[model samples]
Target: MDRIRDLASKKAAVIFTKSSCCMCYSIKQLFYELGASPAVHELDKEARGREMELALRGLGCSPTVPAVFIGGVYVGSATDIISLHVDGSLKQMLINAKAIWF
Candidate 1:
């Protein structure tokens, strides 16, 4: 849990992902399209990945992968992010977090 929090806080925007998850890929692409250079942590490639995944679950991430954090805050999984995007709140959140400008 401590490790997860530490990694999540390292950047203005962070995504906890699994290498092969298509939704993870899409979420990453969305951030790129929005011009936010978010830090990506591929759980499958990390040494303590399973542990971290469990920690993410404890933090309320249902699908586990593609968990997002902005301004060191847990945002949610892919569906939540997509909803935020559709509502035009995601971009504003990115800007407020300093993940993107203008």
Candidate 2:
């Protein structure tokens, strides 16, 4: 828990995205509304991004847009993020990931 928080605090949230992905945009907007300045990594722009995509696939996540990471935890796609917000679980997840206002 502390580790997750530390990572979130240190790195901000990492949102893996692609420029042409609508879900990515939604996720970014949602996070902004949640008061989180998430760092976006475009997975179609660099070699490292490709590596990240492969890694995510290896981790059992869908190889799609808007793969969000809070702290170091995989938080799934844009729809998943929105659901978390709707359920009021997004903030808690962020806190668990260490990305909350202390």
Candidate 3:
């Protein structure tokens, strides 16, 4: 738990993702299109993937793959991002988190 929290705060924006998940891919693509690079942790490819996933679940992000964090705050999953985008707030959130310059 401490390690996950530490890593989440290591960057202004962070994404815990899986390499082969389409949702994770979409999140990465969205950030790329926004010209922002989030610190991505690919759980499926890591030795401690299960442990981290459990930790994330306990932290309130169930189905934790592709979980997001901004400024050390948990920001939900891709669906949440899509909602934010629909409201035209995702960009501002990224900007607020210092994930993008514009």
Residue 13 of candidate 3: its Cα lDDT?
Answer: 84
lDDT sort, best first: 1, 3, 2
Q: For candidate 2, lDDT tens digit of each residue in 40-91?
A: 7777885666766776676666755777878776778777888889999998
Global lDDT of each model? 0.96, 0.73, 0.89
TM-score of each: 0.98, 0.78, 0.95
lDDT of 3 by residue, 1-102 (tens): 997999999988899999999999998899889888899999988799889988999998866878988888888898998788789888898999899995
Tens digits of lDDT, candidate 1, 1-102? 999899989999999999999999999999999999999999999999999999999988899989999999999999999999999999999999999997
Residue ranges of candidate 3 with Cα displaced over 4 Å: none
Worst 10 residues of 1 by lDDT: 57-66
Pairs clashing within candidate 2: 5-98
Predicted model with the maximum TM-score? 1
Which model is ahead, 2 or 3, in terms of lDDT? 3
Angstrom error of the Cα, residue 51, model 3: value is 0.6
